[model samples]
Target: MSLPPHPSSSRRSRLDAYQSLDSRSPTTTPTLSPPLQPFAKRVDSFTSSSSLLSLDSPYLGANRPLSFGEQKLTSSKFTLPHNHMLYLTPDFKEDDDELHMPEPKGQRLGIERDGDFASWRGFVNLGALTLVIVAWIALFAGYPIIYHFTSHRWTNLGAFNLGGTNGTGQVPIMPFHFAVIDPDTPPSAYSKPSWNDPSTSMELVFSDEFNVDGRTFYPGDDPYWEAVDLHYWETNNLEWYDPAAITTQAGNLVITLEAKETHGLDYQGGMMSTWNKFCFTGGYVEANVSLPGLNNVAGLWPAIWTMGNLGRAGYGASLEGMWPYSYDACDVGTVANQSVNGVPVAATINGDAGNGGVLSYLPGQKLSRCTCQNANDDPSKGLLVHPGPKHGDGTFVGRSAPEIDMFEAQVGGGDVPTGEVSQSAQWAPFNAGYIWQNTSTNEVIANPSISVQNTYIGGITQQATSVVTNTDQNCYEGVLGCYSIYGFEYVPGFDNAYITWVSNNQISWTLNGAGLAADAAVEISARPVSQEPMYIIMNLGMSHNFGPVDLPEIPFPVHLKVDYIRVYQRADQKNVGCNPEGFPTIDYINQYAEAYNNPNLTTWVGDYQQTFPGNSFLGQC
Candidate 1:
């Protein structure tokens, strides 16, 4: 149905006014009509349809002419601010068009607005990420540099493993901080005589410098040492001789004594001998040694001495007759005792086998088997038994051996037995003595029924006595300091038989160029002046009822360091030679002797007196 459009009240007013103005005067202008309502809403009211707004409509309201201001507003292109009102020209045309609403002004799709605060936040995050990456790169680059300079380089020196069923574990390959030599410390202050110097007349014989380069598990493998595996020998010691306790380090032979258990014993230590390897008839032997220095702990009996190798092969069969001779430098008093018809008897023989029945036996005569003992039982008395036999025909029986004492120092609280006596504030007191069987007493040997002449005699007072005077200072001065040089010189004569000396700082001798004093020297006019080949033996033994019974507890793993053992013989005596089968090779001896030779060997003479305070006979220099 088609109907004519009705005018609104506002439109009626404008029409009436216009008619009145025309009636009043034909030339008068009428007032402008008020603004029209929105055409979109008016169109919506006219028809209830979604297509009322056409696709190309400009105003969608009335068609009116534009005023000057409306023409200016329509001529300019402007965009509407968000949520602000929209303006249209007064002369508007209707057209169908799509209205595009401006997008919301704030954030979209989680992206922030491009403002000062947002920009600053983004800049800070980027800077933080950059810093993290730079730090990682620096760490990677600098790590190798730091490690190259500061990291520790591990080595197998002075290190050993602690675990294994047989206690023979692989040596650890790690750096031992404590074992490293400090670069700032000075070297050893003392120097020993070189046997090969032209000015020196001695020739090197047998030596074990213990200069092995790599780690050694057993010292016996060195070809020059025979590790003693004996459990007990005369002395009732508490320690068992263990091969595990021996090691070579720092160019020294190290023997450690520990308070641990092994072989069902509470203590363990080491004993090494050159029994069948290298033996000498007469020569000068010395060893540079350092003892364990611990407080309150006693029962340390360390010795470096020699034993007769009579019955051994290569040695002259005639020498086997003198197999009983031994040179001992021991810590405790050495005595020999025998039980006569079930009666306990004792005597102080020092190192000599007294005029007893043991020596009375003729060649091929079997000696009566008697109970013999050493200083292990009582200082005043111990058992002495007959040494089985010397020859296969049972000739030369009994304990006719002579023992020479080189050096022995006993400390802690105990009875002072025989030998040279000295006291120290911080160390074990020292008492050294020498004894040997004097076969020169022709009157006793010539007597018939020599066994009856072997009657028990009380203590035969030693012809010579030794004293430790204030003139000689203590070798070990501090509570934990013990280092000494021990040696002996044997001359094959009754006048000045042998002289042994022990000094803490260096090897020293008396002022007369003799190694020992006239009284301290071991001299036997008749026989038993060390006429047979002997071997070297060094051991660390415990108490044999020898030292103080109330000894303090000893700590574990105490060390004894032997820097080197040097053997020398006079050039004239070197021609005497040695048994090729059992002694050191001649080539080996000559090589070492030649290597150690120096033209500056004469410089040692003056310096030797400063420490030894005596005429120097170490060399012909």
Candidate 2:
């Protein structure tokens, strides 16, 4: 700017300066100014002897070979390596256009898109929904199937045939009903005995004549008879009562006993009872029957007996104490306030309905209340006597429940006496000491113990009051064979003050021949008295109490036949002590449900159903 030098002089100075810079460093030359391009071109072609323009000049063309030091400078940090360099065409120029990378494409980008993810989400949701539906179906369908075989229908298929129909109607498993029998004899044809002069004439109150062939006596088939299909726990018998085993043929009610495994027992038998159907008080009851033959009589205990209406045949309850107590006067002035099984009996029909309460008078019946002060007043007077009305735990007990046995005949086996039949009256005066009583306060005692507080009378043992054995083969065979007539005559003290029992082998076709003569040959008792109402129970049982059954010797199927059963009451004293009202209805469904839920109560081990203390039968006395 201040007096600039000549161009040639300036250029020469610049070239000399560039040469000086190049000589300082042989590998690199300083960048030539843009205005000195002509000078650079000239220097590139120069081939001079001078060192500045020699062939070894640092200012070389692009095609010139680089020296070792030049090669080292090419790899400086300022420049990129050949492999990392952007690809370019041979004619590529550094222009203003933007670079274009390959269009971005990958799986990760596609997954982030909402449209594609929605489909994936739907599939996942469908899978989750399907799983939920499957779970719901499994819950609903599986429960009842699991519950059915394990709990429901267990007893119906195993323990007893609880559901079925006879020709009559639908039959319930409980409150069993029996057959009604109309006797061939008319009331007017019978003559009054000499002992019944003041009493009215005898009228037939209950009768059952087995005249119909192939008549079934199952539950609901007959109004007067019901069969029990259960194991008899009282005597620990080896027989299970089968309803199918009781039938009638050839003018007789037949109870068949079969030696086969039934339920848990080694045998099956037939048992019929008039429970809740026909009951009598002061009356004359008679039955003609034939016992099982002596061929395979081992462990056979066939019998005819009567129990109070307050007890069920094969169930456990506080009311079962009503049996074995034949005398009604045993409880006179005592306050019957005691509860049974913790159930208060202050208010119910006959004191307590199902808890073993006293049922003295029935509907449309007369009450014959009396007190005990004489020989009959003593509870310890007969065989199978009970102690006074005091529990073992110092608690007051209820009234006495009584039973009367027309005959409990023992078939010969082991220590049991054969050909011997026993007749007795039994009672339980104390509330404790029975399987049906409160176990916490009482010990089970079927027979009375000799104690200081009560009088022990003659023939007061644990068994029968009297036993009779027939040695006459004519009494068992011939036209009169197995046709013995057993009669129980009770004349309440109102008009006649005597009770009579007659056993005669005489069979009369007409009602006139069935007379109660006071002959000593057929008369058994004239002293015992019972005023309470009673029901009839007939069964063919095999007892371990007698002896184990000789299985091979058994005639497979044995029969006990009964021609007829008749009950007679004075015309003026009809329905006097009878229980016109049947037993209370039980909730068997709830009972079964309870058994199903409780593992301890279910009968799953050795047997098909729960029997005794593990299971309880509902009853109302």
Candidate 3:
């Protein structure tokens, strides 16, 4: 006897095919009518014949046979063979095992036999599975094409806001690359200069054009600058650097030096520097500066210079070390005699090691002296020089002293007064001096490249001396009309050593881009060139002890108007070093203790007591 095949075999195969197809697509299973009730009732009785049905039916393939209880035959509208039709009868063969269903010959076995409803179910399930797979493939292949057309249609119709003024009257925010600028607008007028040569290309890293309106002073609540409101005692300068004297007006920075009583000092001045805010190794730095009254002022020392940033704190501890070794100072006036026009003038570039050697004054040690030409003239004397140790070769040996006086000039006659009666007989002079020491032998050496008309050395036993006078006729008279560009280019030697065969450090100047007379600039192929970073500084000082037998009275309320200060660096110089450490901040009570040597120097927190209330006073020194 034969029983019906299992219903699960056909259903499981169709379900497996559906899963193997893409799961993202929609799928459906075919619905079948309920199985014949007679077949369901006879399923238990035909368990022994289930294996035979599995082998005979083509739909079952080689699958294992199902038990009689597992087979469920559904109704079908098809003809049946006589032998197979007996299995469909409700009362067919429970006890008599002789009755059997015959397999159909030369035909799809289950389709020709009426009671083989499992084969019909399998055919319906396979067809449904094929339709689902085809639908899934169509959807997966057509999605990209549909998306492209839909997006294009919306974009062309302006349905999406791509960036234009919105209903709120503001432009929609977009990426920076898409923004546009008007071509008619001009670039910034005070922007950094652009160079055509690639080797000299400069990128402006820091600057201040002083263009801010209503700004009375710099770094005014701005973190990029720190105002220096303290006094400097290293040079024994007469003026106290007060922040109140610093102001900004007419789009320029003005530092006023007035002879007013402040902090027990006879003169009050202003000084400002970028100690920690910014510093660079080597650059072309320049400023358009106008000096104060130059007529008959013997001690007015106004300078624009720079100092090394090493070992300096941003606050009170900035000057931790001395200055000569680390500074590049440009003193605008160094006068020896009264000017022909009553206004004396000169320019001096001084570089040295700060406090490296001892400074002592000897009594009655007259090196050299010169007298005036007439009876009313005051006597002139050479500067009292320092002494050095005597050497075995009869030449005195000096300590390793390095100094660079890149340029020095005077508008009047030399130290020796000329006997000429006319005031026009006074001569304008220029000078450059340097004293370089051999690091190995400590012997003083004079630079051969610089030329001087008259040289002076050996003041007192001649330990070491250097002096150079101007051979050129043109001398700057240190006046307001002398608005010229002055700068220095310090290129390091090979391997950044102290000395090299090719000398590159030079001091230069130009009047409105036109070169001055011959021998105006100085180049020293000498040792002791500074190899450290330097920061910029500007100040007005008095009584530096440089010239004249009698100190000339200085005019009060002297104003040093600076148009701008700019720094530029070459594109290829790689060793642009900087110091990031800042010194600890000292409280007001203990400020300037080292400089004054008196622990009782007064200190105030705010810009003096006059600007703010009594609450601003930190403490008295």
Candidate 4:
């Protein structure tokens, strides 16, 4: 009774809004049946297997032409697979009554024809609408594969989580060795420790329990000794001392660095040292190296310096005097300060220098000296002998006794009578109390019990009634440098200048030379006045900035290995038991050997405390 429109004509309705082919035009046109059109020999080829037809053929003779009726016949192979062509099938059965409706009256040409045409058009219209809805759904719900390949990241966030692959964990965390440069010491004398290999280990012990920090110096920087380089020598080289060259090998330490060269260096390098970060402050620190290099020059040097808990903070202080000129008037003829946070500080009793103050380093009682002087007799000299001609710290010699030198002058000697003079070198010793009277000019500053010329090892001095005066200015108001903040110089040589601390103060301290206990010695004094914990640092530095030397070559992969650095914190269960900042005693110092995967617990690094060039958040000034 009806035939479908041609494929092209069927899709025309979807392309334009023109007055469509009149719906009322002609339904009686006998709906072009197969009798008016040609058909293919393979009729089932037009219909997919899922439809009512299927095609499976072995041959179709070249000249064969299927008859009209045979060409219209469809296959009944119902077992074939499904496909899009299945939609073309007449969905009704031969016996289906509704599909067998009488021919529509559309040929009548008016309202009736229009009604008939509309009924047939309804099926096509419904199909078009359904197809549109399906296409829209697929577009919105699917994630396009093309998008994934273009953007490197899954999202537009543009960031990634790298995890812990960064390289910070790979560096060795502990400082393994230390080398000191004092005014009196010779530069070429650099050698290896008596224990461990020079390139792999160090035999220096600096524990909070054994608080024996030493001092070092650079040219024109030892505001304390004020050493005058008569030869104007320069010290810019250092090396790793091997085991065959060490002096002592404590079970806790490996090798030592004893002066090996005979030609002395007179630069005012600082008497730098450190403590803790490894051992408790109540611990002990001992180095078996001596100053065969420091025959007579003044100026101090430090081997170690620790605090109650200095390893954790940026700035801190605890009773320790490794660099005496750093605070006391040890280099009285020179001008330098020993201070903290830009304030004058002292920690020794050398003569009239500490007259009004106790052995404890206090604020106001700084050993005051006269105005700075350029010449040897200006009476005032600057502490800390740095490299520049105008630099301070080197107006004197290291290891030598101090005197006014009002008569016979030396390079750093003074040329004035604060009051009078007593060339007698008869300064008395400190027992409890003592006195003296300078009948000439009568200028008395202090009358400390212990006093004697050449006898007072490394501190300031003043007879019975003489105007109190400070000599070294290393720790003095350091113009605009590191000491500028802490007015006093942190000299390494002073009274019992340096005291050692162990897990408790009972730890013993001894010095040795060539691997045996010798002349180098130290006794523990009272604790520092600060409340901060301590840290450890070993460096062969020149005053402030550090630079590579041009003369000597630094072998790649060379190391300053530390055999061990034992620490002892007097277990008080109260106060000094743990660190003030890095408390609870974080692993008694990492003592690892290899440079990777830190396994031991007695290691630390000096790079963590660098300042000046830039401030190190860990243990900085």
Number of the top-ranking candidate, with lDDT as the measure: 2
Give lDDT for model 3. Answer: 0.35
What TM-score do all the candidates reach, one by one? 0.40, 0.45, 0.38, 0.23
**Which digits, one per residue and each the tens of the lDDT, describe model 2 over residues 138-245?**
789876677564431212211122322211122223322222326354555343442234355676656777777887766545555778777777667888999888
How would the candidate models be sorted by TM-score, starting from the highest? 2, 1, 3, 4
lDDT agreement with native, every candidate: 0.39, 0.46, 0.35, 0.23
Task: List the candidates ranked by lDDT, beginning with the highest.
Answer: 2, 1, 3, 4
- Distance from true location, Cα of 292 in model 2, Å: 1.2
After superposition, the stretches of candidate 4 with alpha carbons farther than 4 Å from their true spots are 1-303, 307-535, 541-559, 563-621
Candidate 2 regions off by >4 Å?
1-183, 186-201, 295-298, 326-400, 411-418, 430-464, 471-481, 492-498, 505-528, 546-552, 576-621
Q: 487-550, model 3: which lDDT tens digit per residue?
A: 3344432233221110112222111101111122222112223334455666665645423412
Name the candidate that leads on TM-score.
2
Looking at candidate 3, what is the lDDT of residue 160? 19
- List model 4 lDDT by residue over 195-259, tens digit each: 11124322222221112123222221111111111111122223321223221222211122233
Write down the TM-score for model 1: 0.40
